[model samples]
Target: MKNVSDEELMILVSNGNLDMMSILFDRYHVRIYNFLLKMTRDQDVSQDITQEVFYKVLKYRTSYKKGKFSSWIYTIARNVFSDHYQKQKNKDQRLNDIHYKTIGQETNSVDDEEIKEQLHLALMKLSHSDRELIIMNRYQGIKYQEIAEIMDSTEGAVKTKVHRAIHKLKEYYLQKI
Candidate 1:
């Protein structure tokens, strides 16, 4: 099963081989969790949403169409976040008490740590759409083509948005310096 591709595993799951979903879960849960964490800035919420993502995948297994599994999973994650965001729209969603330490690589130098902190702060300051773009493109290292597929946009459009988002992030990050 370890040698199986995500799409193949998902196909198996869709056909009632539910156990194959476990392999897909193991492969994507952390990336999905971290992606949610960046979006929500709440570890607990991220954790809950991550679980929901997998649950939705299982629940909607029959809909799997042998497409890029990563793209399908990201689309599910995006929809879950959107649903959660709509419910929480009335409340203050500003980021506070986000921990970059555990999520980020360990750095010995105080300067590096401070820089990372400032970057995260800057990230938190961007509009959610812009922040999402940066997180998908930069932090997650997702290719522009894949991002476009997940976002339901053209690759050129995603590239432009990512470029603009990075520019905005740079401005905000520099302000913190």
Candidate 2:
């Protein structure tokens, strides 16, 4: 069979073709997990959020609209992250602790890893919207137009938000240093 686009796979999934789900999952799972991992900085939370994103995708497939499928999934991922953060008021502090330990274990050079740790800390200091804009633009490589669609804002607004987010991140890095 020919490969289906993510939108096509979602349409298939909505039509009750259960087999299409795995294809959709395969296409997006790694990126979603990695995005969540970068946001939450917890492997387990990333796993849970990734699972939730798919579950929401499957459960709400009937409601899928046309446009960029990745944006739809990204909107879902953002909701999942927000819900998780709401449940744990100290989420950043928890992730901060885990972030250092993870860098220590994963990187060969302590200095490079420490810089990563510092960056992670800087990211944590950013506002939620600022962090999300960076994630959508930088990590996910989402186009500003698509991000505007997902965010329900104008493309110009998305551009401004991303620019402001970058400025905030810079301030965060400066403060950390």
Highest lDDT scorer: 1
**Which digits, one per residue and each the tens of the lDDT, describe model 1 over residues 82-156?**
888876664754344434335645778999879877998888888878999999988799999999999999999
lDDT of 2 at 27: 82
RMSD (Å) of each candidate, 1 decimal: 2.3, 2.6
Per-model CA lDDT versus the true structure? 0.88, 0.82
Output candidate 1 Cα RMSD.
2.3
Give per-residue CA lDDT, model 2, range 60-177, as digits (tens). Answer: 8889876679889989999988888877766554433453226226667878877876777788888878888888789888899988988989999999999988888888878867
Off by over 4 Å in 2: 90-105
